[model samples]
Target: MKDLLIRSATEADFNAMWDIFHTHVAEGETYAFEPGISREEGYDYWFAPRASTFVAVQTLAPHDRRGRERVLGMCKLQPNQVGRGAHVANASYMVSPYAQGVGIGHMLGEHSIGEARRLGYLAMQFNYVVSTNEVAIHLWKRLGFAIVGTLPKAYRHRRLGYVDAYVMYRLLDDPARWPLPEPAPEEDD
Candidate 1:
């Protein structure tokens, strides 16, 4: 219906971003974050200015009645750790229910991958994805993320009791196209 732009997030976006995050977290299927967590806490986590956050904003097209853009989704790319692990980017994405059934998530995810590579990340990893979120899981799999690890009964879902969680990883580079060295053989052998 309109043109969508993915742009860097700012403090002005905190309220809009929290609305989406809180709604999704309250659903108890996608993320491990506590739903009752306060707005301040959500702000601290999602609006960490030091990290990379992006918003999918819908702008009016020519002959449109709306004058301003509306935020449809938000995405954040954070470091998995401080030093050595910083080369890997970890991301979380949320799309407003009003924006569902559209391609907002896919657009945000694709934009995030390009941003990660441009930011010099060697790889991207989703540390804890609930197995029950089939939509997101399927999307990630289609996007080339491999299920590298799984934890049994890792998440304490409110109504579902316990559920499995996954660690998904995707190397940003194509190793086959740019080969690296094989490991040296052990002398004891």
Candidate 2:
């Protein structure tokens, strides 16, 4: 892995964070966010008071004269739901397009899992993963998530039309004691 540092996002990181988020939103393929979303709306969604936002910064080598670290990615972690469902965590990750395929997503995913566990969440769930996003689907599955359910034609892909979305989840605590219900067996004809 590169000399990457993952830390809680601060006020100084908002512009960089927004840049990465806006870029991805403009792509209109991964997240459900609308394109041309305003900075205020982006702030509210990514840096909400209740959510824990993080930034991944790549440190410059000591010999580099520029001596500046760059933000390569960002992620937000929050409750999947409110009240009785608060125990399960949810997260969204975005990597700078220039930094894609460099393992930053894996770092962010692993960091979020630990952070979620530290926050007392018993599990982590991604509610609307676009089924056509094979890279993410593979990554999440490699990171321990499972396709617990699929919402058919849930995502309106900008180019692929309506595509199925997956509900990916992983237990942070004891799996046998996880509170969610198991699927009923299919009846034989």
Q: What range of 10 consecutive residues in model 1 has the weakest lDDT sum?
A: 174-183
* Cand. 2 TM to true fold: 0.88
Give per-residue CA lDDT, model 2, range 55-83, as digits (tens).
Answer: 99987775687756788999999999998
RMSD of each: 4.6, 7.1
For candidate 2, which ten residues in a row score worst on lDDT?
Answer: 175-184
lDDT assessment of candidate 1: 0.86
lDDT of model 2, residue 50: 79
TM-scores of all predicted structures: 0.86, 0.88
Tell me the lDDT of model 1 at 30. 77
Q: Write the per-residue lDDT of candidate 1 for residues 1-189, one digit (tens) a residue.
A: 358889998788778888888998898877788889999999888777558889998875645776466789999998877886787899988998899878898898899999998987778999999888888898899888999999999998878989999999999887565334467788984
